[model samples]
Target: MNPDATTTGADAIDEAIASGNDFDGSPIPQAKLGLYHQVMGLEAGRQRSGVSNTMRSRIVRIGAKHIPQAELNQMLVDADFAPLKDKEIAFYYSGK
Candidate 1:
């Protein structure tokens, strides 16, 4: 597996995700949004392979750039995710 592609632990996952204003709160930077998209895309593939929720968040936090890991987690939680599952999360990244 690619070093950039891996999973994390539970607490770490929860720490990265946000829990306010739906989807990491508004006002996401465009460039970071793009990075979030890329990181998430990679995460989606890993989710398929059985990585833990925390692991997923950690990977994006340490390896990728877009969408701050905390925000991503917050977004996921906002979307009603209590744990990591093999499902895609949506982030309407506006180029603001």
Candidate 2:
């Protein structure tokens, strides 16, 4: 069996979110969908520095929601990306 054939727990949840659906299979709110599409469209058109920079951006954007600052910082360092900047720390961790 291919391990990727079945997704469970958080992986399934992430897939659902990426599909713009809820656990019950209902569509996400139109307003949120609209905003998401708008942002993603902008992101698609934006010029990227490179794959590593894009990876770092994604890590900062999504990891901040799930990982503690210290752990996320360590992960970035281990990945050979620069540590979080002051603005990122202020914006992402300031609410805690």
Candidate 3:
């Protein structure tokens, strides 16, 4: 599977926020959380399929570019959002 073709978890969160849907006071919408799970599942599948860290980094970079550092940090802090792995965080900040 091509990791590049898959939307990153960050992108999903961004889209969810952009949708203007009510979240019942939650920072993230259910749809966005679902998409984040899906993206992580795809990443795990890619790992199982032997995708390299280099590729993962590239994918993270691409997604991170779409979001500002402050917003990304806020998303990371949201209780409803899954935190990214350290390497993914590193990759994201590296691209910022």
| TM-score for each of the candidates | 0.25, 0.60, 0.29
**Ranking 2 against 3 by lDDT, winner:** 2
Tens digits of lDDT, candidate 2, 3-94: 34345554775576577777666788889878977898898899879998888998999999999999999999998999999999999999
List residue ranges in candidate 3 displaced over 4 A.
Answer: 1-63
Please name the candidate that would achieve the greatest lDDT relative to the true structure. Answer: 2
Residues 1-96 of candidate 1: C-alpha lDDT, one tens digit per residue: 222422355443333332211233344466765687689879777735344656555544443245654576676566565532333232222222
C-alpha lDDT values of all predictions: 0.47, 0.84, 0.56
Residue 95 local lDDT, model 2: 94
| Per-residue lDDT of model 3, residues 19-54, tens digit only | 543334335557776897788779767745334555
For candidate 1, the lDDT comes to 0.47
- What is the lDDT, from 0 to 100, of the residue 18 in candidate 2? 74
Q: Rank the models by TM-score, top first.
A: 2, 3, 1
Q: What are the clash counts of all predictions, listed in order?
A: 10, 0, 0
